[model samples]
Target: MLPDEPRSSADPSPEGGPPGCFRHPGTATGISCTRCERPICPECMVPAAVGFQCPECVSRGHAGSRRATTRFGGGLAGDGGLVTRVLVGVNVVVWLLAAYVLTPQLGQTWSLFSAGRDVLGGPAGIADGPDQWYRLLTATFLHVEWWHIGLNMVVLLWLGPPLEEALGRLRFLALYLVAALGGSTFAFLVAGNLMNSVGASGAIFGLIGATIVLQLHNRGPLAPVMAFLVFNLVVTFSRPGVDWRAHLGGLVLGTLTAAGLMYAPREHRGPVQALVVAGALAVEAALLLIGMSLYGA
Candidate 1:
């Protein structure tokens, strides 16, 4: 009989001897797997709804069962917020390094300086050369002022956990990075080459955009999130030193990323979400290249 087919009758014992467990051949036993009908020792038995099953049968059953996932196809493991805490910690450590450990000139190296700008009497910033491309990502984590990092981290702590739980750690991290790069790319393209910018505000704005998208996806109340977004946008435009381009770019990219993630077809969610992120990154890279050419960097 097939392994999973119901047995008509229990198998006879080995010639002149009791049956031994299929797994532990040395152990004699009268019990059999309810599903497979193979002789089983107590150690190899697993409790089932009707009767004990052998380990192999239980494993097969579990293998066929669907795994639990978040509403947006994310694994439930991200609910713990490990990624969020790590991001916050990294931002804080970078800020501390810039604020105290590094000299003023050295710290300026981490900021996203304007294209073709002469810093410390030398060419610096991303658009200055292809080798300095790291600044696009590094600038997001660099901060010299206490209030700048403090406000960003606070918003991150507030928005990160739920979004992480919804999108999963890997997706959430990807969105943050793509948003940060998008912000940097926009700032580079729009702001004068002489204008320098640094802060996690771009990535934080991405989180806000994600939260708003998630709220809409779940049909939840929007007032609270909308109010928060509005206030921040006001600050972005009104504040003299703020890089509104970065904020706007991050927000727009983040929103599109979150929408693609949350609205993807169930059968193709992973691939679709991946395509969305990759597309965003590609667009930003193209824009950066165009900006470089325009600035003669």
Candidate 2:
């Protein structure tokens, strides 16, 4: 047999092992660090009033100990908040679902667009029922392919955190809803039929537009902001599958809405914000109604 290993007082038994210590080499000593679950040495251990903790646990606890107790506002500056996470999740899920179900490239006759179009009206714009108006809201969530959703989600990931933190969740979500409806309204107007266009770009672009106002309101640098806006605008026109009109409409609506929300007077801010958002939406709706009036002519 091999020579027995040397033992010290730190080692509990003659075998030089504690009860919970690892059987193999390079294993935990006795208890794991409560925070990171790492095996810590006695020298590295930090004594608590009740038990011992590792250095990492001591450091983490010490760091958090002096921090303010408030919960809502912290951590958003580092990365993003819950709203940003939710938007990212929603876009990703919808995109993946569309890819599996639709199979757009193979001409498989399966598409969320076509399904939404059929639901809203026949391919020829023939309305089947009065309740079809709701598709305008529902269709905004659908998209055709990976690039489509990817582009929008990338922008959302980039733009959402600052905006969500700046405006709070309710306002950020409201702006998104308005911008999305604003885009669909424009598509309905331009196509004059039940043509379905889907993607989060409109709302993503809205977030971008709102960021512009936010930067302006805060008197921050503008060159980087302008560069981002211009690049995306170019992409909107340069790509074939992209919806430039809806993008443009959403940008304009979002800019106006954000301007109203941020720059408008404090006392009248609510009413002004409402009017600007509602008016932008109404303008697009009127255009669609006017076109529909002429559709049968």
- TM-score of every prediction relative to native: 0.86, 0.62
In model 2, state the lDDT of residue 98: 60
How far does residue 47 in candidate 1 sit from its true spot (Å)?
4.1
User: Which window of 10 residues has the lowest lDDT sum in candidate 2?
Assistant: 106-115
lDDT string for model 2 (207-282, tens) is 7888889888889988887899999889888988677766876787787877777775655755775676678777
Which residue pairs show backbone clashes in model 2? Answer: none
How well does model 2 score by local distance difference test? Answer: 0.63
Candidate 1 per-residue C-alpha lDDT over 27-139 given as tens digits, one digit per residue, 9 for 90 to 100: 77888899988988899988888879998898898999988888888777925598999999999998888788785864678778764543343344676777777888899
Task: Please give the lDDT score at residue 138 for candidate 1.
Answer: 90
After TM-score superposition, what is the CA distance of residue 54 in candidate 2 from its true location, in Å? 40
Off by over 4 Å in 1: 1-18, 47-51, 78-80, 117-123
lDDT of each: 0.83, 0.63
